[model samples]
Target chain A: MNWKTVLRLVSVDVKSGRLIRGQRLRRYRERRLFQYLLYGGACVLGIVIGLGAGTLYTAVPDPDLRTLFYEGARLLFLSFPIMVLIYSLIFTMMSQIQRMGVRSSIQLPYWLPITWEEHTLASTLAHLIGVPLASIILFGSAIATVSIYLEAVPLAILTIFALVASAFLASTTTEIFRVLQARLIGAVYKSSGRAAVWVRFLGSLLFLIAFYVAWFALTSGGGSIALIEMVASAQQAGWFVPYVWLGMALASFMNGLLAQTIIFSLASLLFILVLFYVAVKLNAKFGLYEPPAITVSRGAYVPKVGFLGRLGFSSLEAAVIRKDFKAFTRRRELMYVFIMPLVFILMPLMQYSGIYGTPVTPGSSRFLSAWILLAPGAIMAVMLGTIIIGEEGGSVWLFFSSPITARSLVKCKYAFVIIFSCIVTLVCGAIGILIARPSPDIAVVLLIESMLLIFALGAVSLGTGIKGADFTEVPRPRMVRPLTVLVYGLLCLVLALAIFSPLLLHAVAMEYIPLPVSLPKLDLYVAISISAVIALVVTFVFYKIALKNAEEFLIKAEI
Target chain B: MILGLIKPDSGSVNVVCTKAEDDPVAVKRQVGYVPESPRLYDFLTGLEYLDFVGDIYGLDASEKKARIEEYLEAMELEGREGDMISSYSQGMKQKITLISAFLHKPKLLLLDEPLSSLDPRSARIVKDLLRKLTAQGITTIMSTHVLEIAQAMCDRIAIMYEGRLLALGNMKELRQKARLPGSDLEDIFLKLTGTEDVREVVEALLK
Candidate 1:
């Protein structure tokens, strides 16, 4: 074994890691105002939340119950480090699925004069920053929380060891996920519409269930009944639930069972090493293998398509929407973004389902209905702006050089966003009304507001995308910088308030209409009509502004 | 600019009767461009990408379907529509781009290093295709560093160095201008581009 070469490769990984961080810091530093605003806001918010949490804790009057709750909170806090490790595995695996493996644009090292082993090792080592960083933060926080209620240094040491083992396991399994992601994409991407749709839906549904399960376990915010139920589910997770051993070790430490703690700790270490060996073997078999060229004959099953769209896109604009829709559908990873808003909207329905036997009203929370509309509207808007340009990857030059006008280009993307967002909002709105049964006037007002939100959201998202678009990207890099998201969000918030202002006035005016406006239904109809007119006017104005800005920006766009 | 994509800081571009600045949309419609390494939408199927371009060109339903299928078959891509363009080989992408550029049947065609990914047979097919299009009165301008291909294929050649045109002419005119009658295109290009003694560089490399 060339230990020297391995060490050299390791050093290069360290240097490259440092270089990447340095560049990021430098870029952030370049935008000093935005960076300062973001960091400053976060720090202030942290301080405020900490003070409030402290106040809430001390304000509890029931001493016995409070003590019991303190123990529960300590146990929960102690579970965080272990939870972090598990999450690291889950999230890393999901993101790796987003990657195209050896065919990835980032695979520049494939062309370098390096051995497969060295390349894999260096690339793997380079990513060591993420797991370690998460481990340290969670370890420190867990220790701090537990230290407040108990004094167990030995338990702390065991917890640290378990964390290291978990991190090691997570890091090594990176290539495993890469292979899984690649194979999954290959199978689904090659299939026709029906197969693709099923795979996309199934993938998103699994993640949603997993997300809910994890969230329920961590929060159990519903009550002791929910907590007991979560514990039962955890017990039912079967024999391979080794992750629970971390908690078991902590529980043993809390109860002063040294033997069990020692055993669990040793077993965890052993498991980590076994996983490392398996991971290395998997990496050799999969990650180290070079990707073959895309052979024309391999794809010998071209699917026929309709000449015209189902949504009546007869002109040049249809082409843009068709391409965008196709790209969006083909990349199943992106489907989660599309599915997630509906998931959120369905939350109350799921919560109030017959299983709970809870009394539910569909339109009970007008604010929630508004939130449902805005959340999905926001996602679609940001997607429209960022995705339309970003998904173009390198191929965007085709559109840029085409006979298509900038106005029409912007219009086409916005039209898709409008169509997609409106359909989803209406469906969710109907469901919300059916379940919650809010007043007809409020629902009508919300429908109008939903349309306004779509227009405003698109404008904000497109503007942000135009500012920071890097066209030569695939699944394009974050089109809106974090600061840009905040800025655009604030901008959209203003637009929302402005658009809803007229509707709000109408809603408040319901209580004290003059004698001449005696009929309640007539007044409600008048209010809805006025608001609808206002929404129409606002949408037209914002759409024009957004189009003008986008046209100017695109005309000057370098790539 | 004649490219229609980038605006010229000074001067103007005129393609056919219309100045590019006057109506860039019209100029874009008139011109067919095939960039050397065109970025393709990886998420669309090969057939979908064709239909997309055909729709933009405003081709009728039957015409679009017929032409798209014909070209896909011509390019041996008829069977590849099930897969996303993301899964397509570089040559396949090049073929599709070429087909899109040709499908429009514009007044002018601009192709840049069009045969980079093609095998010999496909390259020959492209040469014949270009000849056919040019014969159909569609003015085709191709930029390639391959001297033999440029000499053999192009009706007129433009040699550019550092973003400035060094020479523009027919094969005979360029030969006369370079004072290298009966000499190869490589020599003429080298003379025009101001590169010195390539034989020495070749010798050094061999050594």
Candidate 2:
């Protein structure tokens, strides 16, 4: 087989896909930023830990520092495989699915002169090329640092082999999962019925629950003990048990055992080759194919009664809300936005109930409740605003030229935001009350806090909505990066600090002034009322600006 | 009576003295719309999408089942229906869009670019579909850039370039009034619309 030609063709195809997705330029910038952040964070963390260790425990000598470095390197090496496997698999599959969809790929072998096996092999190799290289570089650097401290050649060699095996294992597992998922989806589609869809969803949920339970059980003390012993026994038998075997082989090699080093390297290489072969065969059989066809019935239009219907919502608005609610209920990604707030509310309540060792204080309860309500409120606002504007995509002209005015459109979007935020906040607040069993005063405080956070989130949403660019045409999934998340988190923190500054100042004064004099209830009530009024006014002002910004965006888009 | 986005209140929009506003959803079911720019869920294949629209229009289960294969073949997209709509080329998407609008045989078929991106083969298929429907006495309103297609295909043509209808008439009368004897439809269209600049641009690109 002409491997070079296959490689060239693969490269050309990869490059073309990258160009189509506008990824070549964006990916370059992303890579540079990622490297900068990773290295920078690592250096800062290392320095902080080193300094803390030096100050707190000075009994350890230079040998201890060397040992700590080796341990850190080993942990990083062990974890790298799993991280690369999950991230590379998910990112590659999602990006490919979004870009060309499953149908296009299914036609690839038929259109091209190459066999399915060859095409699958080339594509798999092309997909793994980036992540594999990254993994190697990361582990290679870590090994080099360790070598400088310990002068161990065998450790460096073994580390490189282990990482390569990890990358292969990750890539293969990902391919298998993708194939399985596509086939399952296809089967569900062929059997068209409401029952089929529900069965599929329930099956997936059950599988997820089972997997998590198994994982928890496996990691628990009883399971871990048995598993560890089993692995130790396997390592003594031979060098094929992966983690334990590799650990033993590497330890032997580090002690200058040449035979073990050579044997370990050969076994690792054979494992990767065999895995790749099997993965290629699987891809040929099932990988390149159309997604399963599922029939969707037009949802019955039930007239929404009560508060939402009375909000002057038009038919289109009601339809959109109903449709979105149904869609989000089915979507796992959106479920997280709902789930996170519940976690925020429940975690503190759990602590208060003495489920976790700590007894929660009143101040802690207030902080937790406020955070639980605020974080999710901000996320929901951002998500709704971004998607509403962005979903227009290449079809903005239809919306613009429609008889519907921009004002009505904006109003509908805001109505969705407000309604969703209120629902989430109220549910979370109810949970908080159930847990804390706070006095009526605390209930009132919770109400005020909820209102304040909602208004603030409304303003934040408008601001971000205006500034954020729509990437609808781009193939990559919409993801808020860790840094952007941190920034948003910091903004929330600053706002919370500003609101509770009076309480903080009161606490400080109590330490100095020596009196147990609490602020009047009336004064606290007035303060909260003023803050709510100011937040509402700001929200209104931002809403106006956001509306204008949206109009300008629509005009500019001209889609 | 249902009113607001689907129907307007304070007035009767009647079909044979049965006010459509009395059952706006039923009215909407009978009114087919091909949006200016159609967006289908990329996750669905062409046949599945057509079946969905058919089901929504309250077609019976047996009818929907029968119609899926019929429309797919009618649209000249029978074999390709298994492929996702997102995988279809521009012309293919246009064909599916047309098929979706016509699935339930609506009384009023609103079409935008019913033939725009189609190749001659697919365009002819769509033209035949339009002819077959209108022969069954269903009214069809469609927009097109190909004046020749309109002249040949449409009984009545509405010339709308910039959100305004410049002319509305039968083919022969409009062509005759333009004072171009024996000139084909393209020449007459160029003269009426004064799109000489566009012709020049096309000529330059060809050159």
> lDDT of each model, Cα atoms only?
0.63, 0.56
Tens digit of per-residue lDDT, candidate 1, span B38-110: 8776666677777788778777767877787788777787666655676678899899889999888889998
Q: Judge candidate 2 against the unseen true structure and give its global Cα lDDT, from 0 to 1.
A: 0.56
Docking class of 2: incorrect
TM-score of chain B of 2: 0.77
TM-score between model 1 and native: 0.79
Could you tell me which 10 consecutive residues in candidate 1 chain B have the lowest summed lDDT?
Answer: B78-87
DockQ of each: 0.37, 0.08
Q: Output the worst ten-in-a-row residue range by lDDT, candidate 2 chain B.
A: B1-10
- TM accuracy, model 2: 0.66
- Tell how far residue A409 is off in model 2, in angstroms: 1.4
How far residue A278's Cα lies from its native spot in candidate 1, in Å, is 2.6
Candidate 2's displacement at residue A311, Å, is 3.5
lDDT per residue for candidate 2 within B105-159, as digits (tens), equals 7776767767778788878877887799899887787776767777888888877
TM per prediction: 0.79, 0.66
